[model samples]
Every structure is written in structure tokens, then in C-alpha cells.
Target: MQSLSYVFPVLIMLAIGGYYVWMMQKRGQAIQNIGPAMHAFFARTGFRYDHMPPEPIEAHVHLAMQEANNWAPGNRETRYVRMYQGLPINHRQAYLYDDAGMSMSCNWSAPLPGPPRIPFHVADRSLASLGKAMREAFSNTTRCWSAKHPHAVQTGIPQIDGRFLVFGRDPNAVRWLFQQNPQLVGALLQCVEVDLWVDDRDAVFADPMQKNMNAAMGGMTGQMALGFDVAKRMELSIPVHDRMSDLLLMSVRAACQ
Candidate 1:
């Protein structure tokens, strides 16, 4: 009976050890899935890979987790990377691709969507989402796209779209701002191609570094970096649509910084 009593404790210890091993391995795999997403996003934003901190910013990661359940992960058009790094010092900020082809500033947050006037709140979540996305996209710029009325459409012709609006750095600055954000240039023309490709795979984009790298390569590779390497010059313009193409480029410039 004494021997059996010792055996029972041994068995319990063995079970605990096995469970720990299994959990550790699973966590390792989860970390793997997020890597390519990071590489794609930040890489596209022109962040030097050398700048990759030992860990993600803690606050950014926390904010990301708060919105982790959000409907739209990040504007699909921006191909932004979402990461929360610890960096040893633990300064956290959500890393995202602004609609411009550049990195979102460290203090960036998706703004709250509310009408500029009282009693004129946004109704359709889709329009509100678009406005919040544009706020992220054009934070550093002078012009931004927002709904003019609760009845406006964000896409199509802004004027005819009633509630939809446009983003600008002022009349003279549009072209100059357009020159800054390259991803917006792609959003205007190539987003459909990207969307089609992303849809074909049904994979979620979680990393910015790898996304940029794959996109810079012509999107030949899967979101997870399966078995391909796209050429570095993957840029292509979408079909022109009533000057909408230029507007797309403008978004890229705004986001690119």
C-alpha cells in the first residue's frame, strides 16, 4: 500500500509535466502564425528590419487586444501590420498600416466615430468604420475622408454619395500628399487584386512586415509566406475610374509616412 501511494503521486507529477509541454508547444505555434503578418506589414511601411525590437510594444499590443474583436481588423486597403511589442521597456502601441503606405505614428488610435454636429450621429456601422479608418489613414495629413451627412456614401462619387466625403491636405496639397503615401496608390487600383487574392486564401492579415514584403513582390506569395517570393517591384495601377485612381494614390501617400 505504501508503494502504491508513492506511485499515485508519481503519476500525478508525470501528468502535470506532460500538460506543460503540450501547452508550451502550442504557444510556440501560435507565435509562428503571427510572424509573417508582422514582417509583411512593417516591411512595407519602410521600417528597417533592424529596427524590429526584441519584443512588441506592450501598450500597443494591449490596445490591439482590446480591438482584437473588432469587425474590420485594419483597413484591408492599407495592408497595415498589427503587432503589440514588449521591447523590454514595455511601451506598447498598435502597429498599423495607415491608408498611406507608411507606418502609423506611435500614439495612433482608431478615433471614435461621431458626427461633427450634435444630434447628427452616425448610423450605419460601415460608414462609421470607414471614417475611423480614414482617421487612422490621414492622421498626419491636412485632408481626410469623412461622411458629410448621416446619409452619405463612402464609396462612389463623394458628392453624389450624399453622406460620403473626401480627404485632402487642402486643394494645393492633394498632389503633394499623394506623393507621400504609396500604399494609397495601390489601394486606389490594386486593392481589388489584393482583395481577390486574400479572399482566395481566406487568411487573416495580422503582421505588417511580411505583408509589405509579399505585396512588394507582386502578391505571388500566400499571406503566411508559404512557397513563393514576389519580385520587389510588385506595384501596379488599377483601372482609372473618374479620377478615383488619383484619390487612391492620395490615400497611399497619407498612409506611407
Candidate 2:
């Protein structure tokens, strides 16, 4: 009876441990199912799923996570990658990466002929999530640029809304761009956000301890080292893949011109 008591307790502990391991594996498998939905999204958008360029940004991000020891178990197993283009208009590169926690869509445009000498960023008024100070700085610094359209559309080609916040080292270039082509500004405003920086840095915040910051910084650094420009990063929440594609197409078209 005494031996049985010890044996029974050991068996119970073993059973509990086994159950915990099983639950973990099941959770991991559930994450694996996210890949198919991602695949379907690619098919719908006419992009080639899992057909990314060698050493793509997503891959680099994964490598960065590994280097920083920030990787979670099964994190690597859940990543999906795809390549796309703005067909019939722009041939520049575009791609998508969907991971366990975040999804990103990226597109590149041909370097503008004598592109504006300074970097600029524009964000939607409805979506500005930054602090009051940042908002005030952007407003004080960026003028309200307006433009008119030649087409007789239903809306009379609305003026560039006052909601956008544009910041750049060269306000004249931004003003000139808007003055020269209201249509271009209109196209850009349609995008969720735009970043036109000509530097090696990314939109990622500098704090290394923030969520995904290490991976973001390391990935951006790696891309710059590889001689590729990291132009913009638009973080997509749930079910934003289709919208991402449309906005990417519009932004690339407008910026390239």
C-alpha cells in the first residue's frame, strides 16, 4: 500500500505534464492554420505566395529576432511571405509578410527623377495615434496644401483635406508637388500613410525593449546594409490585407510620378 501511494502520485504528475505539453502543441498547430488564410489572400490579390525574393525583409526580421534572442517558440513556423506588383501600371517590387502577431505590406517605387532632397511623412488625421506634442509639431511645420482636379468627377475632385499631416526637411518640395499635381496629393491621401525618407533608418521606434522593436531595428539595419531602401512600413490590423494591397498600389503610383 505504501509503494502504491508513491507510484500513484508519480503517475499523476506525469499525466499532468503530458497534458500540458499536448496543449502547447495544439496551440502551435492552431497558429499553423493562419498560413492558409494568408495563402488565400495572396491568391485573391494575384500575388505569388511563398515566392519572395531571396533574403526578404521578413526573413531578415526572423534572423534579427533570433540574433537578439527574442524569438518565441513556434514563432518561425508561423510566418507567411508573398510577392506582388502593381500590374499594368507600376512594375516596382511589393511584398507581404504575415506572422503570428503582426502583418505588414510593403511596396517600392522607382527612385523619383531628382526625388525631393529630403524625407517626408504623411499620416491620416483620423488615424494619428501619437501624442499632442507630435501632432502640434507636425501641424505647425506642415502647411495645408491644396489642389484642384481637371476631371469632372461626382465629388468635384475634393481638395486635399486639411486632415493630413506632412513633415519634411524641404516644405517647398512638398508644396511644389501638391501645387503642381493635386491629383498626386489626392492619390497619396488615399493611402493609409506615406513615408518618403532617403535614409538608412526605419519608422520603428528606437527603444530596444518595446514590442517588436528589436526585430524591427535589426531588420531595417540589415536591409540598409544590403543596399535596399526601406521606404515605408504600414502596420495592418486584422483583416486589412486587401486594403493594404490597394493602398500600396496607389502610394507607389503617386510617389513614383
Candidate 3:
């Protein structure tokens, strides 16, 4: 019985180690395949990919980091950049870490030509559950800035109002922005999940990766049930550059108008 107990532990440890190795290998292979695809996609779209640091545009970098609740410096990658309709759009990837785990984000930002306007944030209602989980798991500051601002703006369109939580300091301006720009509303609806924030200086858009987070959390829970430690991180399974770019362009055009 003593010898059998010892052998059982050895087998369990070996199983755990093997699982870890397999997961890492799978992730590495995915990165290898994704890298070239990302490069090609950007080339076709006319956006420069990873050619410059984000530091030059402080507001863009700051909003992207803050949106992700990423306190730690330097995991943020400036994935792509281009000027559209006279506004520079910056796309970035950021990682946020907390006791529960880490979450990955892809965000885009464009600096407004003039002074800051009345700030507003729009979040997909479908992500309310995931947003609730994130709020509970991370710092209160991580909560959407709209929470503090506290004025809800509803578009008359039931389809949009039903699917989004839109907040702004000025209800009239918010309503007008959407009313004047049907293309902006259409762009928002076409994407799988999107969140937008408009502060004084910039308009920022994010694909919060809610679907990826839910999938990763489920996978980790399964591993935990099998006696492995939960992997405390979420990864981007694939890039959705095309959808993201369209939303960003439409947003910038609306803001500029």
C-alpha cells in the first residue's frame, strides 16, 4: 500500500506536467500562425502594423491602458496605426492582471482635432454578465467611466437601445450624434461585440474579448476539475482587424462631422 501511494503521486505529477507542456505548445503554434496573417491583413488595409511606439500619442496610449484596467506597464502593444479622414487611429492590445486572472484586450483610439467634448461611453448589453464579472474581479476604477458620469442616452431605435448601454454628460449631443450618423450606428451593430468611449480628446473603441474570456475561463475550470491549477490568463484566439477598423473609421468620421 505504501509503494502504491508513492507511485500514484508520481503519476499525477507527470500528468500535470504533461498537460502544461501541451497547452504551451498549442499556444506557441497559434502565435506562429497568427503573426503572418496579421501582417498580411494590415498590409491590405493600408494600416502600418507595429511600426511605432504608442508613447508619442499619450492620450491614445493612456485611454487604451485604462480601458483594459492594466496598471502594469509595457504589455501594451501598438498593433496598427493609420490616418483616416484627417484623424490618426491607433489600435493596441493590452493585458490586465488581477487576483482572479489576466484578461487580454484589443482597443483603438483616435485623437479629436479640437478640445475635449462631453465624454460618453457605450457598452454592448450582451456583455453585461461578463462586464459584471470583470467589475467584481478588478478595481472599482476599472468600472466604466460612464458609471460616474451617470446620464443615460437612448437612441429611438429599439434595436440599438436594446443592445447597448449608452451614457453621456449631454443627452442632446449624444442623441444628435447618433441621429446624424446612421452609418455610425450601423458600424456598431455589425461587429460581434464593441465598446466605445469618447472623452474630450479622443474616441476609443474596444473589442473587450468577452467571448474569449468566457471560453478561457470555462477551459480553466475544466482543468481545475482535473486537478490542475487554473491558468489565470486569456488570449486572443484570432484577430478581428477588419471589423474593428470599420467601426473605428465610422466613429472617427462621425466625431469629425
Candidate 4:
């Protein structure tokens, strides 16, 4: 829909983007059109989180593990967080992960200012990589101690490395946080990458289904269970940036370094 002028200059970009869309369609073609499907996914997450005014466009994520917990699994932990665009610069992000030792979820709100201006080439391919990381992190659950908790993670990674990427609600602020703190060097070494935002509300909503599946398929119900961070569940919810500092303190410290 870009001006036809974007036609030639962005042709290659468009081709690659088209292929990405094609692949997305091939992989998980929504049963519905883009608008409805997109709205449905995030709207569902929003509804699940807080049935409040303005109907939040919720995006769910599973950072897969806690960055502070050392997320110590096997040699490599995988995870899928989120990828979004067109959100207000002040869009708020809230991590579903609690203050407990248990597994946690990542929740964020980023409604595009005017419309979805994200390029499929960038967001699409980036999403694919994030998905891969998430699956890897989840697949290797047996390797980490945190995996024993009754939750899953869906928050920002805040690393700059090639492997793991998490988008800060405010990239400038997060980048500044990194510069202000240096103790996070080790965490940053882990490649805490910050990325653009994307809606993934279904990730949070699917918690019940996943727990049920695990119980039915893996027979691990007797163990701890997973959960989504319902508004009802939030005994304490702070501004999104504060939440990020607490969760990404170490890496943020490094980025500041």
C-alpha cells in the first residue's frame, strides 16, 4: 500500500517481504483475514489480561526463562518473546513473570500510533528467529532449575547479541539503562538483544491449553503448572519501565556500562 513510488525502490524489499508473508501463510495461515486475525489475537490477550476501558491490545510472550535466574538450562536455551510495530512511543510493557522463583510471563501493550507500519521483511524474519529461540528454550526445559517453577516467561531479553533479542518499550531508555550500569556485563555477554515490538497475545492465552496438554500428554500435572498473568492475578502491577529494570537489571546494568 506504500505509494507506487515505493514500487521500484522497495521492490527487492517487497519481494523478500512477500516471500516472508508467503512462508507465514504457509506455516500458520490465519483462518481469517489479516485485520480480524491480528485484532483477534491481541484483543484476546487484552481481554484476558484486563477487561478494562479502551480494550488493551495485549501481546503475550514467553521469554522462555528468567534472564536474572541465570536461565541456566543446557548449553543453549531457546525462547520466543515478541515482535510488534505501529505502537505509540509511550506504549507500556508489563511482564507476566512474578517476583517469585517460579516461571513468569511477559505482557506488553503497543498499539501502533496510526497503523501497522512494520515491514514484513524485518518483523517477519525477526519473528521467525525469535520463535526458533523460544522453542529451543522450551524444548530444553529439563536443563534449567527455573523450569521447575509453575510459570513461563514472556518478557524482554534486552541483549544486543546476534542470538537473543528483546525489544525495550523505549529502546532509547533501555539503551541508556545499559550505559548507566556495568555490572550487567555478564548478562549482556549472554546476548540480551532488544528488538521492535510485535503482538503475541495468544502466547499468554494459550497457557491453560499448554498446561492441559502437558498434563494429558506428558503426565506432568502432579508437578507445578503454568499460568497466565491475569489482571486478577496482579496483586502488584507497576509502570512497565520499572518492571523492566527489575527483570533486566543485570543486563541493563551492562548496557549502561
Candidate 5:
């Protein structure tokens, strides 16, 4: 009887775990169902998106560590796209919206060189306001900066104005990207933002949470979806994919001048 009791508990545990895994798989399918529409959306933007299932962590980590120079190697098995032929930076695992310029990919690997970092969602005034507060808090303790460029204000996209809040060990390279590529910056501002992982390296783990977080961030959008807070991960449609491609083309051409 005792052996049977033990066996029953084990069975229950297995059932529970299996059920949880099944639920998660269903949710993943629901998200991917929107892929065709997302592809079409990107197509309208004059960019090509090749949907690439997330690569193994070892591959991404090796790439990030060796060749990527400073880019974070994202999570394993988190589906994303490789975007190219249009963006200034050809990105792997870029979301459908605007190539790597504004993907909210959350497939980041931890144990990354420290000093927590939060990616600026869109470069605009609201984020700048947040940056000022952050700068005061960080106070030269780190190499982080909330970069605000006057050219952004001239863009006339109020949302794109002072949106410069960076938190990390060093954001100089990030700053350089913006300064050197004004059009890419413009495209980023127009795309939706997502939550970026910013926590102590030792605390993070490789697990389903990483994929879930990426999926959640991938599905969210809007100004409120700045990824600063968990509760703000709002459900949004991919309207910008259709709306911003032409504008980005025009802006990119103008900026080149």
C-alpha cells in the first residue's frame, strides 16, 4: 500500500508538470500564429524577414562573445527573425516590426558582464526624464548615461525627442551607434519597444522563463510598453510595421543627405 501511495504521488507530479508544459506550448503556438501577418507587415516596410527559430544558446553565446564584440547572446529556442537588406545593422532574431532597429527580443543570456542595463525603448523626452533621475541615482558609479541628442528633437517626432535613458556598466558603444546612424535611430523610435532583462547575472537561469519572457515582450507594444515595469506589458497590434516602413525609407534617405 505504501509503495502504491508513493507511485500515485509521482504520477500526480508528472501529470501536473506535463499539464503545465502543454499549456505553455499552446501559448507559444498562439503567438506564432501571428507570424504570417507579421511577415506581411515587414514586407510592406521594404525589408525582408527570414523567420529563424532561436538558435542553441551555445551558438549565440559563442557568437556574442567572439564576433558580436558587445551584443548580448540571447536565450535558446526563442523564435525570432534574421532581418537584413534594409536596416543599417543586419540583426539575427530581430522582431518583425523594423529589423534590429527596434526588436524587443528578450532572449538574453545572463552572467553577462555586470552593472544592470535597461535598453531605451524609444528615444524620446519621457525616457530622458527617466534618465535624469537614473543618472542622479547612479552618480558616476558606472559608465551609464542617458544620451539626448538635439537632432532627435528636430526630427519632429515628439515621442522620439529626449528618449535617452541607458543603464549599464558602459553605454558608450550604444551612444556611438545612435550618433553615427541617425536614420537607424529614427527607425528605432518609430518601432514598438519591449522589456529587456536587466538583473544581476548570478541570479538569472536558463529555463522556460527566458522563453516566456521573450514571448511576452514580443507580443507587447505601445508607448506604455517601455519595458520598465512588468505590469506595463500591454497587448498591442503590429500597426507600426505597416505604418513606419515608408516613413523610415523617406527619413533614412533624408538623413543620408
Candidate 6:
């Protein structure tokens, strides 16, 4: 009976390990299938597509994500480029790794005509769950105590102020930019689950994968959750191109003004 008990547990572990490997292979295959569709779509739209970013674009991307100490760039599988409203925009999937794990971040960036300016960052507050909120609160407190964090900029508008966590080198400039461009605030609100940053050379918009209970679940639930994640990743990889382009154009225009 003791031998039976030991054998059952070993069998179960083996089954679980086999299931995990199978799911991973399936996910990889699904991701591979995505490339052809992406290429075809970009080709039809007259946007240039590349498996890897050109050197200049890669450098700009690295600089943009460098300020956030938690994130380091990973595989940037899809790079799409096109000119709109007299500005060239680069849209790509940037995989970023942190202490927890890697996440695929959908990133869009466009250069400004003028010289470099102080950088600012925006994050959607509405997306945070209780645990994430608590973690961020603790992190913020630590940063404040250390006197190493930039203060958050509040634009008096309740909707904007409540929904976003904004940080910048100059609070007055950040507030003034939002005040002058109500349209920009409106455009920003339309972007769900997205984060924004305006760096010295370019304005960037990204939607990084958020860790959730689904990612932490186990057994059948975990398998189901991972399947959903694969589907979600595919959806984000090839979002509505026109809508994204318009959002990028409007948001950048408002930010520049």
C-alpha cells in the first residue's frame, strides 16, 4: 500500500510534467502561426515589417525602457513602420523581463521634430488589482522615503487624475500639457490597458502583460489560463491596425502640442 501511494504520486507528477510540455509546444506553434498573418497584414497596409528592428530603432527602444529599473528588453519579434501625419511611427512587440517573469509588451513609438525634452510616464491606474495596488503603494512609499522618485503629476480633471498615475521631471509642464490639450486627455482615456511615455527623442505607448491570478493558478485551471493567455497575446500582437494608428497619431499630436 505504501508502494502504491508512492507510485501514484510519481504518476501524477509525470502526468503534470507531460501536460506542461505539451501546452508549451502548442503555445509555441500558435505563436509561430501568427507571423505569417502579421506579415500579410502589414504588406497589405503598405507598412514595412521586419522580424527584428533596425539598429537605430533598437537603440531608441533600449533607451526608452532603460529608466524603469524593473524591466529589461527581450525578444522583439515584430517590427512595423509607417509614416503618418508627418511623423514616422514604429510599432513592435517588445518582450520585457523582470524578477517575476517575461511579458510581451505591445509598443508604439514616434519621434518628435524638435529637440529632446524632459521625459514623462503615464500608467493606467484602473488596471491594478488589490494586490498590485498594495505592491505599488509600498514601492512608492519606499521610493518617497529614499527621496529618489519623481512626484506624480495631477491634472485636476477627476477622470484623468483618477484613472492615470502620471510622473514627470517637471510637474507644472506635465499639468500644463494636459490642460492645454483636453483632446489628448480624451484620446488617452480611450486607450485601455496601455501605458505611455514621452522621452527625449520619441513618444511611446505600450501595453505590457499584467500578472494575475490566472497566471498563478494550478492544475486544470492553470492549463486553461495559459491557453487564454496565448489567445490574448495573439490578439494584442495584431490589434486593429487602423485604430492603433489613429490613437498613436492623435495622442502624439496632443503630446507635442
Per-residue lDDT of 112 in model 6: 73
lDDT of 4 by residue, 1-257 (tens): 66887787789898999998886564343222333433443343222222133433423221111232243343332222222221121222222333443343232233222322211100112334546578758875311111111222222333433333333344454444444544443433422222223222111111211222233322454332312222211212222222223323232223222
Write down the worst ten-residue block by lDDT for model 2: 202-211
lDDT of 6 at 107: 64
Model 5, poorest ten-residue lDDT window? 201-210
Q: What TM-score, over all chains together, does every model reach?
A: 0.24, 0.36, 0.59, 0.21, 0.32, 0.55
| lDDT: the better of candidates 5 and 6 | 6
> Which sections of candidate 4 miss by over 4 Å?
1-106, 116-257
List candidate 6 stretches off by more than 4 Å: 1-40, 50-76, 94-103, 116-119, 126-130, 133-149, 210-239
- Alpha carbon lDDT at 57, candidate 3: 47
lDDT of 1 at 241: 21
lDDT of 6: 0.59
Clashing pairs in 5: 74-107, 75-107, 123-163, 124-162, 124-163, 125-162
Q: Is 2 or 4 the stronger prediction by lDDT?
A: 2
Q: Count the backbone clashes (under 3 Å) in each candidate.
A: 47, 0, 2, 39, 6, 0
lDDT of 2 by residue, 103-192 (tens): 222333223333434334554443344564476587653222221111211212245436554554455654544465565565555443
Cα lDDT tens digits, model 5, 1-257, are: 88999999999999999999987675455344334434443343323322323554334334323322332454322232322234321222332333333223322222223332322222324333656578757863222223322122133333333453333223453344345556555555544441222233311111122233334356444333443321223122223222233333333332232
Candidate 3 per-residue lDDT over residues 20-139, each given as its tens digit: 999877655544444444444444444554454333443433343343443346344446677655557787776767685666776777877765445667777744667666765786
Clashes of 1: 47
**Candidate 5 CA-lDDT value:** 0.36
Q: In model 3, how large is the Cα lDDT of residue 234?
A: 15
Please state the error at residue 173 of candidate 1 in Å: 11
- Which portions of model 2 show Cα errors greater than 4 Å? 1-28, 31-35, 46-120, 124-162, 168-173, 179-239
